[model samples]
Target: MTQTCLVTGGAGFIGCAISDALTAAFDTVVAVDNLHPQIHKTGARPAALNERVELIVADVTEPGTWDEVLAKHRPDTVIHLAAETGTGQSLTEATRHAQVNVVGTTRMLDALAARGIVPQRIVLSSSRAVYGEGEWLDAQGKGHYPGQRSAQMLEQGQWDFPGLRSQPFRCAHTKPAPTSVYGATKLAQEHILSAWCLAFGTGLNILRLQNVYGPGQSLTNPYTGIVSLFARMAKAGKSIPLYEDGHMLRDFVFIDDVAAAIVAAATSDKSGILADIGTGDSLSIAQLASVIGDIYQAPPPHVTGQFRNGDVRHAACDVSATRDTLGWTPQVDAATGARRLCEWIDQRPEQLERL
Candidate 1:
């Protein structure tokens, strides 16, 4: 008998990519998404999946919605990707983020429990924001800075505590310090998954993805992924807006690579494990803008405004654990991915306005 896989938020960017990959391997793929107009307001629904995949439109937070789908499908694997995901927005709409990210995840786990089916695996799409601003430690490990930023620190890639020598920069792993409501809720969800595994013996795989980018990304939301926003601006012949000095660094992982990692995690025997999914490389906002400009044969982005609240200067994943556990690594570099995205935009001028 072939196995069944269910992917929540399957209509969204990353979720859609994972659903397409799962449909190719699993006998059945059930994609559930609320089709929340807030995240992806307009665009043609995501394509590139086999006929075996079934699309279910429902909010994951509602208990009644998943009960039928779960009972009918009884999926062997559940990849939960549904959530309200924006750090800045989450700061203002804390309640909504908590309702969707934390409450929705709890409901999904509850649905699985009600069916008396402990799925072979449950894969969660998490985020690096759980680390918050990331801890800064000195060489002696005695000094620590939680949320302080300095110009000298950025230049040297080292943060200095008042009384200690500067040390290699490190994000705090001691305790989760979520900077935004979204990050806090994601951390809560991760802990909840861990608790479920310990209490019920369910297998769980948590993947904290970095800045994921590629085609099919909705560009209407400027508050979300930067790559999509930049692509949209370039296509429109408008200068890309730099949020800061364009020095903010981010780990940009291609969508295909992210999908491959999710597939690997679902197939692996690993359980109750949290791993970072990224290319292990950092790119500045300016660098990213230049690459996109090159791809579209357009002028460089015009620096516009300064960084706003809840924005971190830099954040990148280690990816060592991901490599060891999933046996997967990013295949597409930033340049290649940017070019591919530009090509897609060029081919679909009509879709630009919809985004």
Candidate 2:
């Protein structure tokens, strides 16, 4: 008997990659996505996945629709990745994020319970934003300085210059302090998953992913698609805006690695656990621009802009749990991944022209 998998937001970037991976592994794959224009531009559809996979265009928040999908598919595994994802915008549209991320997740859990068909596993695509802003503790369980200083030590004179510290940061395993509405919604979703696991005995695996970038990413949207935006600008010789002094550090995980991690989490015996999926390395926007320039074999583009509000200065994952539980680690480093992304973008001039 072949196993069936249901992937919510299967048409989106990471979701599409997960869908492809599922089709290769499982006997059947069912993808559910509303294809929201906020992420994918209006009338813009995600690239088609395998022909064997079935696509359903429905919002997960709608209880009626989920029941229909659940009854029709009866999937053994449900990978929920559909949600309103944007830190800055989530502040303005808190209710919207809550509705989609929190309410939609509730609807899915309820539908599964109603059918009395508990899936073998439930994978959630969460975000690192749940940790929120502030000084994060280092691996040694010591409190570190905020922002870039947390990751690196300052020189002798630099220590007194301003933001520099000598001790590791204090990190606690407790309730998250969400800085944005998006983070709050994700926390709520996590709580919902925990409840389902405890109350209904459903298997759950939560993946709190860092910045994931690769090809087929929509570049036209400035709110998202930072890598795509930079690639387009580099190809067209346009100025790229660097949010903040371009020193904000981020852990960029390749899309393929993310897909692999999701698949592993679904297949693994680990349940009711949260794993951070990232390369465990940090790179700044300026450094990222240089890398992209090198990939395109072009001069580094000009960067102008201050860091926007609610932006995390530094975010790198501790993938030990992910490795120990799911047996997954990120393979693509920032430089190699950026080059791959550039190569894919370079083949399509029309995409650059549109942006």
lDDT of each: 0.77, 0.75
Query: Can you tell me which runs of candidate 2 are displaced by over 4 Å?
Result: 42-45, 134-141, 144-175, 297-305
Residue-wise C-alpha lDDT for candidate 1, range 1-355, written one tens digit per residue: 8899888888788777776678777888888888777665653455654456788888889998877787688888888888898888997889999999999998988888888878778888988878766655565666454563445554554432344332222222434567677888999988998888678777899888888888867656666878877877776667777866777778898999998999988878777667788888888888999888776666778776555556666777777666777788889988888888778777887767565
lDDT per residue (tens digit) for residues 1-355 in model 2: 8899999888888877776668888998998888877566775456656667788888999987787797788888888898888888887878888999999998888888888878888898888878764454555656543432221223221212143322211123423556678878988888888888777677988888888899867666666767877887777665566764577677888999998999988877778667888887878788888777666566765545444546555666667656777788789998989888888887887766665
Report the error of model 1 at residue 54, Å: 1.1
- Cα TM-score per model: 0.88, 0.87
Best by TM-score: 1
Q: Which residue pairs show collisions in model 1? A: 135-172
Cα lDDT, model 2, residue 247: 71
